[model samples]
Target: MNIFLVPYTRWRHLAMALWCGGFGLMAWWLVLALTVVGGPKWAPEWDGPILLGTIAAFVSGGSILGEDNLRRTPILKRLLRGVIAVVIAVANTLIWYWLLQLVIPKLLPDAWSADAADASLVSLRYRVGDFLAGGLATGIACAFVRKFDHVVSHVAGGISSALAAGAAWYLLGSNFQGLTDLYLSGAALGLVWGFLFGLITWPIPDSLYTGWIRVLSAVRFGRRIPVDAPDGGPKERFVGHFPRGLDLFLPADQGVAEMHVSVAVDGRGRYAARGLSLAPTRVKRFLERVDIRYDPRRPAPLETALSSGDRILLGEGEHQAELEFIMLPKEEM
Candidate 1:
């Protein structure tokens, strides 16, 4: 059988591998610390949260790194900033978990360990609980670490695989269990469990994630105002290229005045308008406000439309008006 060590380019794969390895080791260490220093009695029960929090911190750090890189920030400076951000995240997690531990004793009396003797059953149940709790914690963490979702997912998968392998080794012992037998059994069980778990908790769609980011960006930076048309009529229509599934980002109060506006349909498709128009330059400035989407499949200069109410007229035209517009790339619109 052919083995595919890494799928992406060498540099990319190396960077990803290093990031994952570093983060995975951090997670392992955190788990170990919780068990060893935090007290094993509580460790077994809190293992999921500790590991999940560690993963969250890694992802949050990676996201900060990625965002800095995307904004054309210097690599060395970005790296330093990311490291600082990660340290803060780690400290936050530790504090949060510590507080949770304090609160748990007051809330639930039996939120801790079970002294069951059936080794296999206990491990199996603990594993299942860990998987569920870890997955949930990871999902929540993903919300904060949106930029590094792909990397985080890959790292999480790798760590989970390693843990499974360790469990299998413990189960089979040193007896010359055929390597092939071990691999097949392990692979099968992993697949079954993964599939079952995935079915139970469906993942968030890519579009929804992007939409949330866009909404958050808008809230942070404020909305874009477009340039008005020459005739002084309200610039009721907005047209722009936006990422698919981001239509949710469009405000609901701003009705879709029209569908398939001629400007958008002429050559490149344009997203319809909804909001107000300010100045053309302001529109351009607003467009640059955030990384709306990251899709390589589409073209450049994505467009965004504005309503007549939003338009700030520069000059009137016989039929044409100077309107503020954001040219979004086909990929990001």
Candidate 2:
């Protein structure tokens, strides 16, 4: 199984969000305590609060899990991603502060109060900044984890994060002025935000697992066995007749064994089919229509690389079952 591209479920996503938010509450307390003890006394009035919120965003962005629970992503790489998140969070905090607190007030003199420094924490400008900052940070963080190449995935992450941040800011009354607010609204906001983030950005059963085995000329013609494994971890399917335990259950009378054939995607993203049944599975590639029999006794493994539109014949005579492999386009993911 390829660990990197494993699909992410909704429950896992919500769980991750909770983890981040729980950490966020503690992070707020830690940052506040540090500010009171050693932070610059002459720092701007908004500095401490902004830093606290930014750190919360850092937690949410950095704690996002890309792979499934069974696999362990390298700790060093995850830390590097966290550091990148910190940089993004810090930069966003400064930029938004400058725009909303300094520039916007001067630009809209009548709309903004003269003492903008004393503006309400629930102000519209602050909320807007929160939305933009949260979105940008989340998008970049997801892209970094996905190897910085999946444009659609990152875009989805940005939109979801932005919406989550905006909703939290608006619904929670936009203030973290007290410990009560920090713990209550903070944890609630994290739960809601993380769920939304996962809803849109979580991986699907596409990419390497994007295919299906369709019954061609069998008793159950047109039946489909999806390429995705149970729980979306391994990109392999076990075709058999033993009922519930198999990935693809076929009729036993059709020359299929308890484990007939195993189709899987290798680490290099190539699909291969291995014959397991003593009944000799026959494969015909998409490019070549001639039948090729798997020889398990040979030094080479009894397997063949599969392509879209390939066919696998499972039995002999009128009782034979033919299954066709159909691969979907990855771009659709």
Candidate 3:
């Protein structure tokens, strides 16, 4: 249970943690405000520490990497990373809050609670308690659930976990009415935020690499461009290019005999290029990062295999596109 075992540099990890807080705060308020306006009077206000905790566990491929690590770990040693993250998220967030209070008191005083001015240890205890309560309840709720698929699925889990936590707090004769809203808003927003964040950072991994044949030299939008250029966007090729559809329309590269080359991105993130064109599609592979080598004159038959940093020439002359095999890494998947 080495809680401090982070693989990355401290500053960068802390930066990302603080970056996560921006989205977390948004998630907390959006749910609370939406529920308060249209729903029951007893709904809970945003649970700040819980929001931070949940964000820390899940964002930016952290949870996915964690899950993979857990699976690779021996069965007896597996622990709930989500739970541990809850503590870390709260601790880090509170530290950030403390700094904000000290550094920007006159300008950002409204951001801090009255408790922020209280004795340091007491403030820490309150925040820690706030995180633990939600963390335990959310972890329990999530354990009984499966991975989220649809947007509604996120909403459901949020409500369920919030209610579960809120009920516990209510029985303690704390704010019972507040728990009602807390349960609903927290559940709904948690799911929604997770879903949105996934899209924002579509982390495509190196292993499950969906590759593309990028144009290194091309004549497009009016000029003969020479040099490998980045694509307009990532093309997740379920089906490689053809004349009809599911492709990038390469009309200029007539040297590419229609259906010039067929590419299949394999399971291990490798791209296998087979020559579909009657004309030999030259698959020039770069050797030792210096020399260029040919792949069997290729590709009037299956010839080239391209990984990261590899290149291909689909056609000759005006229709020529100097192509590269491009892949998004595991972190960006």
- lDDT assessment of candidate 2: 0.58
For candidate 2, lDDT tens digit of each residue in 1-333?
133333332333454444555544555556556667787564456553464345435554545433323135476765666666556656655565455556655665664556454534545454465455555555555566556666576666665655565566455654445333433454444455545555555544334335678888747787886675444455877787888888777898887778878788754556778787777578886456433344557764477788677888886776677888876433222
* Winner by TM-score between candidate 2 and candidate 1: 2
TM-score of 2: 0.50
Model 3 lDDT, residue 212, Cα: 45
- Model 3 residue 23 CA deviation in Å: 21
Q: TM-score of each candidate?
A: 0.31, 0.50, 0.32
Give lDDT: candidate 1, residue 85. 50
List residue ranges in candidate 1 displaced over 4 A.
Answer: 1-11, 33-44, 63-122, 143-333
Q: List residue ranges in candidate 2 displaced over 4 A.
A: 1-16, 19-26, 29-44, 47-53, 64-71, 113-121, 124-126, 144-147, 151-156, 159-163, 173-183, 204-333
**TM-score, model 1 to reference:** 0.31
Global Cα lDDT for candidate 1 = 0.36
